[model samples]
Target: MGVQFGSFDSICETAALVICSLVGTAQGIEPSCYSRNVEVGGTIIFQPSTSFVHIVAIIMTAIMIFHIRSKYTAVGRKEIVMFFYMYIVIELLAMFLDSNIIPTANSSYPWFAAIYTGLVAAAYCCLLINGFVGFQFAEDGTPLSLWFMRIACLVVFGVSFFISIATFKGFAGFSYSKPIGLWIIYILWPIICAAVYVVSQLVLVFRTLEDRWPLGDIIFGAAFYTVGNVLLFAFSVTICDAIKHYIDGLFFFTLCMLLSVMMVYKYWDSITREDLEFSVGSKAAVWEVKDPLLSTGLDYSEEDTVSNYHGGGVAPSLVGGVSGQQLYQKGGMGGRGYPPSDRY
Candidate 1:
């Protein structure tokens, strides 16, 4: 049942109370979605389905990294590629956390979870920053822009890490029972970042680009992201029960998240183009062919004049003043061109 805010005297007070309740309520601690029956002296595998999804996400992220790197001339390549790297890290940590490979009782769980939380925050922060690259607020792909993004992500990661560790370890008066800080860092922060990124990208597309195809990519990404989170936070338990514990929201959530990331890549690739002259890929060569007979009003330098071909023996009119058509006439021994030696 949902909490009734109607009883509260004012909206501000109701908001305050809700915020207070969020403390020590690390809601990520949910029931295991599914587990496989594996017994080698009886050890049940936990959330194997979700773990498999994590593995797939990792592979997909690596593929995205390769593809993004290949676009050497694309704007914001370095900055956005960093997001996928962090994502890979997050998924690796999640595989261990969700699968219970790192047991909850393990003393390192809180530390690892804190690191994971921080990385997730950093990744989202990176995405939010990247959304503005098209605005040329600073030159994209420059060291200045790259470092700015790196430092911003680092600061966000550090703050998120502190909050998470404080909550998990019950330090700095952060109670394990009231993990509001973690809830904000882990859940609310990502949603805020995503909203900002989407808004910024929409502005970029509408205000800057002539082609609006990226809008579709943005829409698809937002849809996948929305569906993934909804499945995870709203209907995980219900789906878990409905599926007879075979799989749950986490699986679909992971899949949708992957699709969302792919859309991010698609949108970026759509907006950015390679300078083909400097591109690493092979390009067809086009040679210019000029017919000497048809060439007229051609200006030749002193070194290229027909005088050099005739060894100063031709008349002054036909020497340096010769037209391209006269230079190719049958005057020399070969009768095909002016000079038999082919100097002309």
Candidate 2:
């Protein structure tokens, strides 16, 4: 049964490849320029490199869904939800295009592409947002430096969004032809965003060295995401030229998978630790006996004792086996219950 479904999926994928190839051939453009690779009849239809990426994306989508449904913290939950939402949108848009519901050959397709691209763009933006939120609400607390990083990320996204819009307009004007202006908008803008994010994250990692916190996770996770985006942008540029585009897409997909796994593990560990501590502490208190007789005549003369038990006066009988003499000397024999002379 599993094999049959798998075979069916492969056939559907091959059909999608055939359709894309036909569309590209009819439109006088390489189908490889559109995405990763193409496959036909259990063989390479256009480019084989892209096939692996599509496969990984399909697998990762399932894993992401699992993570989203499981227990997660507020930040983890938000990031997973955003990521899943973006992917869902992208998948739906892709299906729409593949089904010929939206014309990818005409000028209208560019608009459709741009809209779908914008949706895909949100995947990275949401990740950046998650990193910022994590840094802001870290165990130690929100720091000014983290806030600055968050703002910097926002600026980068804003600029990238603007450039993406311009790029889409250029594409709409030109039917998938290569243009320097288009390259600047599509390629350079994404590169800049990646570079800024990477550098900013590196700076944060170095600056917070002395701080006792989970700085490593933040730095490494951000670095993975940044590098992945950079590679993806490059892949988008060279997708038309060679099979390398598919390989690059595979790399980017793998990077995203790693990032998601890291986040899930990190937060899961934190949640588990917190639960463990609470469980142990609760159980410890549950077995505690509140014997007022054992505490009697104990001299809590030390300032630490008063400070420790400031909530209420310690019951003298709670002490195990101390004499009145010791109690008086320790100054715990106060005027509350026992008189001064009575102590001797």
Candidate 3:
């Protein structure tokens, strides 16, 4: 049954690919500026490379949903889940923009891109938040450094957001052949986010050195994304002739989502750890029994019960030399009020 489903999914994916290829061909992606070439009349063209990115986005989005629903968690994880939400939004917007264009100077493609920029910015914001929360929250506290990093990211985002709004950097097509200042506006957030992720990862490595196994998976996956983003940024800026950059898996975003999905899967509870003993404990306890893995909250009553059960037993008079029946006889220790026995 599972194999059948897998085959079915493969078939569906292939069908999707065929459809996308047709769409791209129909739109003249080969000569379209969206594919890195200018049309004769300046009509923006969608490229096959860009189409592949859309395919990747769709696949990863499906995988993300599977991971989230498998847990069946009904509450919390708002920030962590929000990261994926924004991820889907940004990816879909990229795909959606691929099929659209500013046919005229006054067309709405530019506006569409502008609105999408904010959503993408917000998505990257969640990614930063997840990075900090994943480590510090595991230890059951947020350090001053994490808080500082968060505040700094917000400031950067705010400044970048304003600049982008004023310049429509959200349109973000280097093919548009805009001036250098405007290009910087489009690339600002990616540079800043990648820088922050790399630094945050270093901090995580130091903080999690003691944890020998599980953290490695998350660390490596996140590193892949950070490094990929840096490389992608470089590639996008310098390698205009290469069509591979637009292909979904070849670009930074492919690395971003691929590694991110891995990290999310490996460390399924990045935001809140149910095993963190600090999250749940008795507040009114006079003392605490602390441990790295758990806490007892000085539960003396339970301790006493345990101790009593182990160290004590039934009454000697009732069970040892004297039986209950003999004890309850006339003139005995547990006797009725009657004539005394001669031995007593």
Ranking by TM-score: 1, 3, 2
- For 1-344, candidate 2 gives per-residue lDDT tens digits of 11131122222222222222212223423322344535456543332334344445556666767655453333344443554555655655555554344544566765565555455445455444543443445542235443544455455445544444454454344322333333343334444544454455445545644442444555555567656554543443353346544343434544464564455345323422233432323234555547976557565655345342564443344456644444655445464334464568
TM-score for each predicted model, relative to the true structure: 0.75, 0.43, 0.48
**Judged by lDDT, which candidate is best?**
1
Q: Candidate 3 — which residues are off by over 4 angstroms?
A: 1-45, 69-76, 101-106, 134-162, 169-185, 226-257, 264-344
- TM-score of candidate 3 on Cα atoms, chains taken together: 0.48
Order of models, best lDDT first: 1, 3, 2
Q: Please write out the lDDT profile of model 1 over residues 1-344, one tens digit for every residue.
A: 43222211121121211122223344322343433434334555566777788899999899989999988888888888999998999999888777667766667877887888799999999999898888989998899999999999999999998987887667898765656666677667888999999999999999989999999999999999999877765676668778886776777888898899989999998999988667686557776669765466565554454464746444445457855555676773246575564565
Query: What tens digits encode model 3's per-residue C-alpha lDDT throughout 79-145?
Result: 4565576667666766656544433134465455555555566656656666665465443123454
Clashes of each: 6, 14, 0
Q: By TM-score, is 2 or 3 better?
A: 3
State the C-alpha lDDT per candidate: 0.75, 0.44, 0.48
User: TM-score of the candidate numbered 2?
Assistant: 0.43
Query: Any runs in candidate 2 off by more than 4 Å, and if so which?
Result: 1-49, 72-76, 91-108, 137-185, 196-344
